[model samples]
Target: MTATASRHRLTTAKAMVDGIAAEMERDESVIVLGEDVGAYGGIFSSSTGLLDRFGATRVIDTPISETAFIGLGIGAAVEGLRPIVELMFVDFFGVCMDQIYNHMAKISYESGGNVKVPMVLTTAVGGGYSDGAQHSQCLWGTFAHLPGMKVVVPSNPYDAKGLMISAIRDDSPVVYMFHKGVLGLPWMAKNPRSVDEVPDEPFTVPIGKARVARAGSDVTVVTVSLSVHHALDVADRLATEGVDVEVLDLRSLVPLDREAILTSVAKTGRLVVVDEDYLSYGLSGEVVATVTDVDPGLLRAKVARVAVPDVPIPYAHALEYAVLPRPERIEAAIRAVVGA
Candidate 1:
């Protein structure tokens, strides 16, 4: 009952439908196909009350046919079944990118590993409510630059019920990605930090680990889902303008925690990456080539990113927050990488 008071009763889409109803009540092979996840639980309510407790044959409710229920959830996770598939829109993944990037992410390295998909696909990405450009994109770097999945991206509801119970007890394929403005959606636009406290029981947030959510030495914003609440509201408005921002939070982009982005840019030598996807080859140029692939002299200036520029997300909520990365473009890329 403690873990932050069981997150005040859940809402990053009800802690991702209580981590897919605690892995479908401790795995009766964890099924849950998409579109309105049974009895209308997930048009982003993310499986609310999971079809009155997993009835209707493990909460089945498919038909919008994203490539035939994501190719029957990758042949029910390659015949073993731990599926949680729900791609209800990370801009529809181009009507099923061949059942998510070629067979729920390359079916266990093309079967040399004797197939074990173990799936968790869930979706619903970003855009501040205009939901235009084919329902607003946050492609999570086109499913974390393809290759057998584990993309995650929970930025609240205690890492969305511990990364949806560690992406339903991962065996391989994951790609979770939440952020329809952090899923507090009572018709969007009131994200009190994606509703807090989470942890009623079944826990686990470890999947590449990057959580320095707000500690600072000067400027490091990095970021993930919902731009990690727009870099923690521009690290609490640039810490009252003195600007000691450091907000990492890369909660798994196909295991891109790269030593916590080089230990938060070696303790904030300044690096602002805040991405709601788009703005060049994604995830803010792979977190600035993961800190210049090791050490662009650990940044001193010129690293700011604040994404969404590659255009096409407009339905006019003032041109979709004029290409979101919002908290005023992550406070002008964390005060222009701390040159303030």
Candidate 2:
């Protein structure tokens, strides 16, 4: 099949917003709604110029009521519109949990397949930007626990664009999480042959399909979001010491690529899960449980999890850094797994 080929230099945030705008233009049913999404063009400039392009009817700016706007988005989806609602920051999802978890997610199942809520909820997640506890949070784990929602966390510009497009077109409620830290990095924009080969035309990376970003056999490192980059960095460092580690980026968390996790564990015989969420009942715990339950003999060493402590995020930069997982922590975990 022939593929669309185009190249552009843009930040991860810009690419994602641009992809959303493109999809909106292609589909008349698609609309954007959130505080400052129209006139202000979003708090992070992710939606700049959208209001001017799509006009106020499509690019709506709502009051500072997340619960109300999210519910409106859900109701709109139930009708015919494919609304893309921005929650500003994922931490603020608490105010709209009823709409997201109970209403939109359960509507189809609760109605015995009579209704389908095809909407995308985009939010900023992760720490390191000094946004304090309310703004800087990696709450993908919260939505992952929900039954019907698909959770996606893109690690780079390419994945960000493709995954956002996929989320927009998906027939179920999808939470598209963009990490605040990697939005403008030059490395994320690098045209690595692997990702540069991504189709220029709009396409979807199937949800729940994990990508082995870097392959090796000594140990398997499963992570997502900012942790994916950290794991890759640690893998590179370990390679210099003759320790081979395979890095799996679990781009979508809810429909987790369980087969990929099991296969990688079987090959490496050791596993380490790095997540930005807290240690208790988080992504790390879920991954370890899944691997151990599938094949106890596949693990040569006890599975290790590098995660944040089970505590509220501190406001101090030093304390925040100490709480979140880092490359050093991932490197240590890899070394421990490989007996290096």
Candidate 3:
């Protein structure tokens, strides 16, 4: 596998494919198994050119049996193989979640550390382009709530590449959640951050760490995935009005970088959690608890949250936008938190 050009701009999909290809080249045991991953190059093009580069054997295209293919990946991982399995849509986890939660997640612990499941379950999430309730959902919270798997969501090309590399190497089950809105797909709405300069070398962004997308002292907004872009846009808009907003992009969820969350909240004294997942029993609530758990005295103003309400994502554009935590809703939440 050749290195990407230095500082060359790559879309999120390209970066992801490059990272997987690089790892597969370095480790023959690293194989990909999923629907349409071969000739189709993935529905969102995440596996574009992988078949040509690594051939059908390594990039195996399984039948439309999520349960069978996912179970096969888990067995392969236990036998000392690193498999990157694509689930197509995060919303479709119900089809094979038993394998994911019961076996893939707990096998290492159940085996008393004798076995390891070094597998990457890459899936697309979010609902902006009216894909309907069944086809679209940012179910990261559900995965994070589970005990054993690592949940990672990258907002940009750089982090996408780095996190994918890290997930491939990690000796545990990993849920790599990619929002279709950030995939830089020609058919979907585009965010500027989706396509950016990615380093040429095979680099790994430490999982369980958060990146401050924009530093500020006025208010802190903690978010992940596509919501990170919305927060950044709000941050920039607020900056011009003399209201500086700090944007924290949580690249991974299972590890839950509490220290980073506390550090930013302590500095700004105001916290606003923006999550694409549902509001109740999700990332938003966990973030609020993380801040208030240590000392409620740290908050200078009331904490606010921008998240999808406890409702299925609507298929209509207006209804879907209303449920999603878009930039307008995020900006309002920020203003409320900062009293700006």
Q: Report every candidate's CA lDDT.
A: 0.82, 0.84, 0.93
Q: What is the lDDT of candidate 2?
A: 0.84
Instruction: Give the clash total for candidate 2.
Output: 0
- For candidate 2, the per-residue lDDT at 289 reads 84
* Decoy 1 TM-score against native: 0.36
Which candidate would rank higher by lDDT, 1 or 2?
Answer: 2
Best by TM-score: 3
Give the CA lDDT, 0 to 100, for residue 7 in model 3: 73
Clashing pairs in 1: 7-197, 7-198
As a TM-score, model 2 comes out at 0.93
User: What is candidate 3's lDDT per residue for 256-317, written digit by digit as tens?
Assistant: 99999999999999999999999999999999999999988889999898999999999999
Each prediction's total of clashing residue pairs, residues at least 3 apart in sequence or on different chains, is 2, 0, 0
The 10-residue segment of model 1 with minimum total lDDT is: 1-10
C-alpha lDDT of residue 158 in model 1: 80
TM-score of each: 0.36, 0.93, 0.98
